[model samples]
Target: MKATFGIKERLKSKKEIELLFSEGKSIAKYPIRLIYREATTEKNFTIQTAVSVSKRNFKKAPDRNRIKRLLRESYRKNKYLVSKNTTHHFTFMFLYTGNKMPDSIIVESKIKEILQKFISKEIEKQ
Candidate 1:
């Protein structure tokens, strides 16, 4: 698959977001946290994802947006790990928990690590 995060792969429904946070399980690797839950949706994609940066941590709109961008790009590049390993549909929220600014390399590595952990956890469940 192409390394793209298109509109269809985005999670935008309020009800779905609420359900995801309420019922999802999470895995964390330091500054990056992945909150995910199995979802039953009519969409064609295998996963729908959103990225968030805590306002409390960044304290500036530009800072938050930058981190969110980094998180999304990293996930966009590495999300094949999820698509290839699992058959279930899921909603994911990637939350940035650190207080300092992050570089692309750090974000990408952490995103890959967290995604790998998520895949391994799912395999164990099966």
Candidate 2:
């Protein structure tokens, strides 16, 4: 609700990440992909999330870090869409699948689209 991305909201545990990947469902919008699963967390947070950029696409650490930063920023701004609508807790991973360097506008717009799609899919599942 504070629009802050804090430590408790980060997906960091090795076990949790493994479980999410093993049982998660994924949605993709061109250069970005979302992998998510319903999960109960030890913390009070409703959603725990992580972002990744493929090392293969960006050979330089700075490039990958930059893209990851963009992904996190986009998600942070739009996280309320999922938080406000969902009754269940979830773990999420956003993967960057594109090779080119991205602009913030493009990343933000795509993140909105991707989250909309995810929300729609969740509705359909209900």
Task: Indicate the worst ten consecutive residues by lDDT in candidate 2.
Answer: 37-46
**Backbone clash count, each prediction separately:** 0, 0
Tens digits of lDDT, candidate 2, 1-126 = 878899989999899899988999999988999999889655589899999988899999999999999999999999999888888888999999999999999999999998999899889889
- Once fitted onto the true fold, the runs of candidate 2 whose alpha carbons sit more than 4 angstroms away are none
Which TM-score value belongs to model 1?
0.97
Clashing pairs in 2: none
lDDT of 1 by residue, 16-103 (tens): 9999899999999999999999998656999999998888778889999999899999999999999999999999999999999999
The per-model lDDT (C-alpha) reads 0.94, 0.91
As a whole number from 0 to 100, the lDDT of residue 13 in candidate 2 is 86
Which is the leading candidate under TM-score? Answer: 1
